[model samples]
Target chain A: MLKVIAQDFIRHEFLETVRPLYQELVEKTRQEKECVSYHLFTDQKDPGYFIFIEEWPDRAALDAHCQTEHFRRLVPLIDSYQTREGTFLLMDAFSAAADS
Target chain B: MLKVIAQDFIRHEFLETVRPLYQELVEKTRQEKECVSYHLFTDQKDPGYFIFIEEWPDRAALDAHCQTEHFRRLVPLIDSYQTREGTFLLMDAFSAAADS
Candidate 1:
């Protein structure tokens, strides 16, 4: 299995404006065939910042997600209120045994 | 081996306010025996937002990291910031196959 983790920061005030749209996109992402899990989180002290953590069965699943129409359609909606584009600046995948 | 993924977001302006300190903490984390990788990324379009992605060998290693003095000392320094407190908000761990 391949696991992917991505992060992005956003303005605090933007949370109110983007929460609804974010929920829609997350719902769509969660439904994807390869999605193992997906979620959103906000900083407790810093309300402006938020984070999204995702897990996929493999790179192929993640790649397919990138090509989906739902993913494509999200950009414009995200751009309207976002001050900056989120970036997957870090990427790593490797085989391993379960730690437990 | 167990892979741990964590995500947290910070405001754009706060990015600068905390970059130096963040880098120090990350450096300390990377030196831990179980760390496979650690990184920080800023939004391409948004100056105020940033993310930290981490990978650890297992829960034991990750737990030890939390107890380290560097980790302990980081709190008060981080608390001095203006807006909100950062949160680990999301954490996931599992074994995996290399998806090359």
Candidate 2:
């Protein structure tokens, strides 16, 4: 499986303005293939920071999703939040005990 | 194994200011027991966005890491970037084939 994770340290003052964009991207990612799950969660301990988790059947499928129109539009808006700074992570996963 | 991922959309302008902080973190996390590997990567397609991937031996070790002093300090400095808006993700991983 392929797992991709990212956390954004957004400006707290702009939190309300970004909610609609967050909601739109979440909905769009869920509709894609290999997207087993996608969610946006806030840190109870950290108010403005958010995390995004996505799981894919394999890397190729994940690559395809990255090229989608939703991804294209989402990237720019997401970048807008980079007014402060954020990060992106790409991970290749190997699991030892699937049924454990 | 346990997997944890996060992405931070750092302000492009402050990217250099956060470099020392990022380096300090990579070293600290690398020394932990469950950390098979942790890397900070930039999106080739996007600038100013960063991703973090962490793998642990199990959940217990991960839980401990969270309570560690490194985590306490890391959280606050990271939150300072919330000038725009960001995210955090917590995932429970189930693998079908670890030795595959």
Candidate 3:
């Protein structure tokens, strides 16, 4: 499994404008066959900062997501609103056996 | 609910030392009545860096967690291994209707 954590610090002015777009992206992204989970979180202290935590079956699945029409359409606008392109960290998950 | 995303950049030298402590912490934390979920992830590109994603029923639950003997014992050691104290972000989660 591939876990992706993306931290996007958006310009305060764009918070309201981009929220709906994110809502749509989350909805559409979850329907993809490769998506295990897709969640969106906003910083409580700074609403403009959003974090996307997602799980995918593989890199190909994630790549396919990036190529989707909604991704292409929405991501650019989302990017434009950010102070930086955003930070993406790919991770390997670990869990204690007791919890697992 | 209170969701916490903590990013820790551990000193490469301390990776081996902290792994077991973290594992123990995760196990103990999940056993707490107020803990909704707890997950640990290590950055693929940088094994020394870790991200902890956690959920608690409320502030009291979180505060109680901070007071745990295991938490108190392990966290300081974990913090000592980091280059910087680490960045913690409190977030409000949002999900698409299709998902919910």
Candidate 4:
């Protein structure tokens, strides 16, 4: 499985504006058959720091997600509110046992 | 729910030493009743970067995890191999709708 950790630091002032967009994207993405899991989180200490922990079956599935309507429409809007460029960490489960 | 993203940048030479310690922790943590999920991942682009994505029912449950025998035994040994200090991001789900 391919796991992604997408981290963003949004401007404090744009929290209200950005949240609904995230919700819309998340809800829509969850319906995609390729998505194993999709979750949105905010740092407890720094509310503006957002993280999306996602799981996909493979790179093709993830690539397909990027082309989805919600991703194309909402991601750029969300990017405009960022304090800095977001970080995307593509990861693999550390062990076969951990994959379970 | 409490979600934690624990990131570590391990020294290159210590990857072998650290991997087993992390596996031990992950396996044991998954057996804990309070642990909703426990996963270990290594950045695909940076093998030395490790991330632990964990979920707990509440603060008390998370605290109890810290006091577990496996955690106490493995974490410090794992820490010793880090190139720099690890990052611990305590986070909350961004929305109630996203919780499922």
- Native-contact fraction for each model? 0.02, 0.02, 0.77, 0.73
Number of backbone collisions per candidate, in order?
A: 9, 41, 0, 0
Question: Scored by CA lDDT, what does every candidate get?
Answer: 0.58, 0.66, 0.85, 0.90
Model 1 regions more than 4 Å off? A89-100, B1-65, B68-100
The model with the greatest DockQ is 4
Q: How good is the docking of model 3, by CAPRI class?
A: medium
Runs off by more than 4 Å, candidate 4: A96-100, B96-100
Model 4 accuracy (lDDT, Cα): 0.90
Q: Rank the candidates by TM-score, best first.
A: 4, 3, 2, 1
Evaluated on CA atoms against the true complex, candidate 1 attains a DockQ of 0.05
lDDT of 3: 0.85
RMSD of each predicted structure: 12.0, 12.4, 4.0, 3.4
Instruction: Find the 10 residues in a row with the least total lDDT in model 1 chain B.
Output: B91-100
Question: DockQ, per-model, please?
Answer: 0.05, 0.04, 0.49, 0.55
List the candidates' TM-scores in order: 0.47, 0.47, 0.91, 0.92
Q: Say which candidate scores most in lDDT.
A: 4
Candidate 2 lDDT, tens digit per residue, A1-100? Answer: 6556666776776666666777787888899867887766555455566667667787788788879998899767866864567764555432212212
State in Å the error of residue A65, model 4: 0.9
Highest TM-score against the true fold, candidate: 4
Local accuracy of candidate 1 as per-residue lDDT tens digits, A18-89:
666666778899888788877665544444444566767767888898888887887466666656676553
CAPRI class assigned to model 4:
medium
